[model samples]
Target: MSQKHLTIIDHPLVQHKLTIMRQKDVSTAGFRRLLREISLLLAYEVTRELELTTTRIETPICEMDAPMLEGKKLALISILRAGNGLLDGILEMIPSARVGFVGLYRDPETLQPVQYYNKVPKELDARMTIVVDPMLATGNSLVAAIDLLKQAGAKNLRFLCLLAAPEGVERMRQAHPDVPIFTAALDERLDDHGYIVPGLGDAGDRMFGTK
Candidate 1:
């Protein structure tokens, strides 16, 4: 999956919210609120192709057939702390989605991701799996996370992030072309520190006020 396989959600609302989130002085609560709101919008774009089934139901006016999502429930896998921010908002849109988490922390010296936790719903092969992470900078962690999911039998998968760097996107494309990426913004190069340039700056720290 090259850049062609990536979907940059350039919707006005998404861009506007992302601008606010990128500001240096925004409060933690404000950042969280914007992320949740933007996640709802992104969720709409990503799930546009969901399989639908017709069901007979009674509306306020009369009985009619209604289209509803078909097959197994969707699965949302949040990539640790920052991913949780996007997860909360997406869950609001799909309350029935099964939730999971993959906890990985970057090794300071080597700048590599180390997994500490992994848990996901069963029957992943039967459902669409969306992995959420706020920042896709180095792409190492995202690759590792997807590898774990595939090993667990997840065939259909997607990656969602707020900001993505070219390096990360390319890395993902090479490592897992089968998975399409959905992002709010495709930013400039990653800095030497492995942070996306002009990014919201340490998504987990800003979201949680840890910095």
Candidate 2:
């Protein structure tokens, strides 16, 4: 199905947090903390299509009907380690949302992503899946994740990330343009090393303090 691809780079608070996250000298603890904070901010854009239902309820003073979210739980799929950073923060607000993980790593030979692990909920067909990753550098991993989700019967899909490069966004646009993408900032370009230009460096490494 064709879907509108939306990018969230307009919010000031989002921009500020993203800027801090993108600095080269930021500490690992600080980098991870910022990712968590930015993910919450990005979650606002990702949940725009959530279904809402109306019900009768009573307030402390007034008795009135209110609108609340309906059933068919949401599935927030994280793309392994770095993506896990966002999961905790989003779960803080919507703790009941079902979680899924898709583990994909770049193959040493092809530099292509290889899926090594995937354990999604059994009722994926009835859920709205949002895939989370910190950066969209090559777009291969995100594209691969979306492809796998489609094969699993996930029709409604959205992508949430901290930052996206112009090249990666365009590549994703061509491959899966129907999927909406949410991120705090869109950098000018990707460097020759397959990293976002002026990107904070390997998100996983920086976030984990490994390098």
Top model number, TM-score: 1
Note the clash tally of each candidate: 1, 0
Q: Which lDDT tens digits does candidate 2 get at residues 1-211?
A: 1235757556888888887877888888898888888778778878977999999988999989798988788999999878898888899878888999999986756658998998777677888888988889888888999998888889888888887887878889999978888877777897666878877788889888888
In order, the Cα lDDT scores of the candidates are 0.93, 0.83
- Superposed on all Cα atoms, the candidates' RMSDs to the truth, in angstroms, are 1.6, 2.5
TM-score of each: 0.97, 0.93
What lDDT tens digits, residue by residue, belong to model 1 across residues 20-108? Answer: 99999999999989999999999998887789999999988999999999999999999999999999999998999999999998886
Q: What residue runs in model 1 are displaced by over 4 Å at the alpha carbon?
A: 1-3
Clashing pairs in 1: 1-177
How many residue-pair clashes does candidate 2 contain? 0
Which residue window of length 10 is worst by lDDT in model 1?
1-10
